[model samples]
Target chain A: MRNVKGPEIKSVEDLIGPLARVRPGRPGGEVSGTGARTLLASVTAEEPTGRTAGDVPVPAAVRRYGLRRLTLGAAAVVLAAGFVVGPSLLEDGSGGAASYANSAVAIEREGGDYVARIKDPFAEREEFGEAFAALGLKVGLNLSPASPGAVGEIFRVGTSGGGVGRGFVAGTEPSGCSPSEPGCVMVLRVPADFTGEAWIELGRQARPGEAYRNHGSAVGRYGELRGTDVDGRPVEEVLAEVRRRGLQVEFQRIIVGDGGSLSFEAVTAGEVGPAWTVWDAEAAMAGKVRLMVTPEKLDDNPMYEPGLGPGGLDDLGESDEPGKSGEPGRSGGG
Target chain B: MSDDRPARFEAVYREAYGRITAYAARRCDSPQDAADVVAETFAVAWRRVDELPKGQEAVLWLYGVARNVLANHRRGETLRRARSAGLDAEMADLYAAPADRGVEMSVIAEVFRNLSEDDRELLSLVAWEGLEREEIATMMGLSRNAVRIRLHRARRRFSRALAAAGVPFGMERRMVPAGRSL
Candidate 1:
């Protein structure tokens, strides 16, 4: 008789399968160590008075939650498909139960706002997305691995691109979620009267000295001006526009060498603002770049597009390629 | 129920300890973290012993609990810093620092890291946890259909990524089974 088999093993599965099998083993010894005994003792001593895992009754909130979830799923699909669903089509009325609980998060009506108890901060991003979606608000919390100092800590909170509302900020940490606690739960309060899309970034601390990548850049800090038109325009015209906007302007004359190579030198023209602009007529022909124009001088260089890095223009001195602009403000002498 | 809690917890603990340790060890950066994950998971089980299911179900449920605990730990929420000296020492026993995966494995790991967190989690649940679709649905609080759809998409994305990275791997049937069509 021929053996009947299930579906064929997939390639993706084949690749990752070994990661599961070969795990780092714990050092072997008696399992009943003091840590074990202490934990057992603590459990024994503490009052066992809470609902069991997955035992909470499905509350009426699930009904209201259902429609919101349906809408959210539709919105996500539409967005993922690259079809822009208007905000009006996604509008949801707010009137969820005062208290809602999930494995990932818990919500309780507090004062005029809703207090979200983040039960598992390290829960997958979709889980957080679902929890917030159920509450009939476009809010999200993104927790990711971070350096030890920033771990489990709220590093920074601000509105991200095209989010729902303004004035959203991190409130106090929930009493239950201390830094030392396993499964720290954080409490976030959104305005009771406010509803719309919002997001917050949370940090998960990596093991001490573990290499953690910081993808955040200090780009677009004050503002930015870029594009071929913006760069092609005369330096004086750009500065005039900056002055029109009631902002300070600092221009660097990008000088072109006689060999047709580009370089940057500070604009020392007291009247037009930099001297190189007057001396090097060919400089303006190369590119009329507005290197820096902020309300105030920045501590670090402003963030710029990565493509700009090839020309040696990103605020961070990451590129070492020749013909690229040197550090912000300091010019590569022509 | 009270009288049975300790024995029940102990029995399940012995049976599943290594698996849970492996689960956490594979994901965690250090043995201490894995130990803490194990300790917290069992501690939770003991406190809620009455709710645990019978036989293999309890093991599955424990896996669910450990999953959440690990998530919280990864988010850097340290609960119970003062775990008994003994527990700390025991946890340290579980700590084996990760050795470098030489070139090929490292390349695979890099490409895998490049995938979305959701994709990685879906693939890992299948590859690392060995969870079937339905089991993954239960653990992740998604419907079985959702799990299947996501798994398929995740697989497709991984395949594309691998191909883009110039990795040689097998191709599985791309179409969903008849009844499971999305």
Candidate 2:
């Protein structure tokens, strides 16, 4: 916690301590030309047929699934948090919930007769206050940005004003972007001494669960990099840590496609980032992990799992032609 | 150092790509933008690895590069909300709303709205981006502790914004309610 101003890797190591373990899965695989071709063909479903993968491709179904294959289609959804709405968007992974990367938490709790909509974007501070005003509940804004090296120092700094919400909100003047820019989420707080129920609403558009924002694009679906050195820290333990900190996530349904593939996220730390953040990864990519952004949306969308295929609904006209999951670059088996 | 640049570049790139990209994503306006930042930083290091002193010192050099990249990036955009100078004004009414990163960033804007463009740069370099206080000081041409104190007060102002807006108090329960915008 002392301000030693250590090396970048050292600092990053201190921030994450160690990456929690990656959930069990093969993060990377051979992307052969055939595979690429298949992926290209697979995403060619132009309309929705609502027939499931085995049936013919309905125009409507192909149309429905076509969006998944478009370049940037993935991050478009994550960024939708800047815009869209849905219950699936409210899943907050705090209290060591690390696997559900970038997921926010929103819960409507029964507070007396009124419903308290509590949400923790884990990014903004004022929403805590707004969440309070909306639901008439006291709020606790946990400001934990993932950092390295100075974990103790960072913790001290975070705990500086007593505890999380106990202290006043820290203000940041926009250094580069304007208040109108994206990172402008605000913070609101009630005195820790105040008495009332508290609830948080957390959610982001489910548009991009197929690919969480890993390194720019949603292609970050692959995970489980054991035994890698990050910012001077050993990350073999990150996998376990991910399990340890991952919040219990319950998918509406877990499915395996005709080919036996399913993307499951393993997390660590409830979404509020870690206790601290590390501006590393260059020295040793701390806090950052690789993931395979597949063509899977959360429960918000109506369709079969990636295993199910793009033509499941029969609403979109899809045919037995193997490449029609609306998924970009995938193999189809009827 | 130049001779060893490639080795260091590979080592650093192999290990740091994801996290650095994530950092860039968090800081930059877009993923493509973030990628450009990460990619460009490494590109620079590849060219000047020899100049980067060994060990932890190399890391600082990397930071310098990233800082430059970010500064350059912002400068190019030309949409700084506030303009000009002057900010001895006790940054009162700083309201931080938990917007999405689970922390309300808008509040940072509300509270720091009164600060001159320079002050936001000075404070954000430390508070939001997680840069060292001294590093921020160096970047902004300010004294070390002076930056620290300003940052501390900035946080306080943000906290006050929460109180004045009364957004975080009881509003949490009804987020995106039946009436409000989703």
Candidate 3:
């Protein structure tokens, strides 16, 4: 077949014009609230038992029947447990998830997984340490004094070990708070078998004019950072300037994909100097900056899928700390 | 009094329902499957509302969730829930033929279908969703550079595929602005 001259695609948008043309479906305004309500009830189980319009008790038998009807054949035991626990948590509506006002920590069991909701952003770090110590399940959220610009921001989050992971917090906002809203309440899902901590660094709301350090952005290859500091400077220049200032720089090679480019991250262990601040301002001008520097790297951003994390396991109890296996405080960078 | 979890979730539901439904309807083979995808996607969203992105980002964030849900359904990782009845009924209405939208682009579709899933998705995000590289990066949890490079490669591969499929040069070049090439 003679190769025909193709379209001179100017942008990514133009490249797949035909595919877009052929793509099926447009927005249809027919979504019912049933699915949302059901899932909400299952997650929170906050309604009165079997009485509220939203909360329906999901019996083990019903789940078993659902499993059998689908004939998944495998994972029947797991799915049955999920149907039972997930809906049951909400069946009573107000029970199951434990709340501690002292540490502002609330622990609830949903779908066999333990979800720790940090009700108080002002709770001391050791308080969390205490809560995890008492529960025998470790969960981490690092609240630090934030820069005036980043007050109440969730700068970075890290998770480690198997089964234990952190929730996805959208954009620059914290896990629970909306973008415009102040205050951050973190919700972390601990796997039933997870014996380690999922550490998160949140920017405590700063008083006006207070100076604070900001965490670096996790920039992927070709990721651009906008602001006066980095608006037009080449990547090489930014790195060179950082090194010139006698600061340590690290690079994480791209192990995934074609490995065409390297992962770019920079950080200072202490407060960000005036030099870094320039770059941050410039980068923010463009968009969320991409230099994933932190005072310390406590956790790898977990790959949190939709639905709660580890909602099917049930064996987690007050086990002793598993030898600091996933401590975020020790991982240093700023 | 302000709404509680269900009410807050309902607001998000109303805002994102149409887009998510369209996403599922386009990807799933049947209304039932679409229903499952929609139901499961919203269920997941409702469960994680506190963590959901605010504003328009919520919709894009949801695309990521729905993508995962669809993958699970395709892999048979999810149980068929009776909760999808409402979705099934709603999608049934949308199962109607999308009027002659792709007739002229049929050949393009054929060539596009020959590409890999990643490439197809990258291209679709640009063309179908009209997301810029930055938005695509955020949506996919990738760096903007990765998106840019990957998107560039995807377009090149698509152009090659189109040429191999014997599409006319003028028609092909028509889509690309002047001075642009594969």
Candidate 4:
């Protein structure tokens, strides 16, 4: 047997005897901590309640989750086959869960080829405008609505003829009512090949002693987004107050650079912590893209897709019986 | 007797569920992900309930099912790293100061992520699951002696990996820390 040595091992699935009794009315379902953790606030480590360790797989389990999972497996096979695509059409930030039915879309098929004119169940909705306004931070759009916690889709952004697609974005944090310290803020991320960059600009009130000079060109900036006091006001009022404070945002022009290099980055600037959480999968960011737009210039304009209205994310596969009560229930007490 | 079986199954589920959960938490990186392995493992047993051996033997065999399920879990761990649209903007910095009440969790998770899936699972089997080499052998289909040797190696490896990952190393695997209650 090719053995596992002291240094070659990583983790193990241990089995301790059961704890406590659930007899009669006893609340035998207590789930004390088991030491598993997730860095992203939304990525929870649930318990495997109502299930055991000595189990096997059968047809029913597969049939229930087959369609959704099959899609993912199919995607994996495509990427593994080295089929890469451009980021130009990656993010569809039209608006919440809106659908353009029976429309022909694009796909990266096996052997790294583009399968054009393929019909998608739905085209991603672009709601970055509403999301930007709702969060009250100045950022750029390069997003679309898709379920990551459920069945994740793919998104690739970069000038490299071949782009990397991480699939989806899910998980959100509680929204903030004000732009105070430690609150969530809205931010936009863009690839160097951004055309919207030149059109982008920033606007925020700069404090007297709170210098913005030390910060190099806005691309590599790291500031606390110091806010002005909007005493005891509603969230919308605070949004308006912040906008009137002039422009403090850094501007950038998205330009596809040399060597056919592919770079990725995330823009975290919002009052809501999860607002900054692009997806629960990756952390930090890498690149040299400049920030653009002030809070005022930041469009509080249309949030719906270029055509659709609100209620986009509503009723999407919600009735799909997510993690059913009986199909091998997992402990939600993560 | 027909009525007796469902009651018995419920009893078994109640007694063994948390144990399996604890076992999975130690080995798998995230509870939800670990729970997937655990749930799948137990669902197999439940479907093939009649095939399970009697008494303590059954417990040991359950460990075998968990082993296989975890193997499946490890294979898919790579998917968790794929790039996403909002990952940079949304995901909290893994190295930043953990602001909330999950420091122990973050530290443990960080340590867990750094370890290879194999070491983490075998050690968690012993420490978190409290399985003996003999029982583990039955579940994994290995010889008893081989189980002992493998378990020992797994434990040793876990210690070194934990140390390198900055987890409290001097402490034993069985020593449950103050934060991870139950």
Best by TM-score: 3
The sequence of per-residue lDDT tens digits that candidate 4 reaches over residues B44-128 is 6655555555445565556666666776676565465554535734554552442542454455555655566665555545544
For candidate 1, what is the DockQ-based docking class? Answer: incorrect
Candidate 4 lDDT (Cα, 0 to 1): 0.31
Q: TM-score of each model's B chain?
A: 0.74, 0.56, 0.74, 0.64
* Candidate 2, lDDT over the whole model: 0.31
Model 1 agreement with the true structure over A1-334: per-residue lDDT tens digits: 0001124323466576544434323322234667555655665565555455633221111110000111111111111111123222222223333455567776655655566766776688787766655555566777655332233434334343332222333322533134445645555665544544555655454443332222111111112221111222334554544444453433444443343343454544363432112111111111122343322322222222223222322212111111122233434222
* Candidate number of the best DockQ: 3
Off by over 4 Å in 3: A1-9, A22-99, A103-115, A119-124, A138-140, A144-180, A191-334, B1-111, B130-156, B159-182
Cα RMSD, each candidate? 22.3, 29.8, 14.7, 25.4
- Once model 1 is optimally superposed onto the true structure by TM-score, how far is the C-alpha of residue A258 displaced, in angstroms? 62
DockQ of each: 0.07, 0.01, 0.16, 0.04
**Candidate 2 chain B: worst-modelled 10 consecutive residues by lDDT:** B173-182
Candidate 4 chain A lDDT trough over 10 residues, lowest sum: A277-286
> For candidate 3, lDDT tens digit of each residue in A148-209?
33333344455554342323231222533432365544454444444434565655543333
Better of 3 and 4 by TM-score: 3
Write one digit per residue (lDDT tens) for candidate 3, span B28-140.
Answer: 66767887777767666655655565556677777777777777676563344465767867876886744653543666667777889788877766666555555565566
Model 1 misplacement above 4 A: A1-10, A20-47, A51-334, B77-100, B171-182
lDDT by residue for model 4 (A1-334), tens: 1011122322232111111111111221233334211111112122213334433432122111101111121212212111122232232242211111122222222122222221222322233322322222122333222122111111211121222232112111122111122332222222211112111111121233332211111110121112221111223433332234333322211111243221222233453221111100110111121132122321111111112111012212211112111111111100
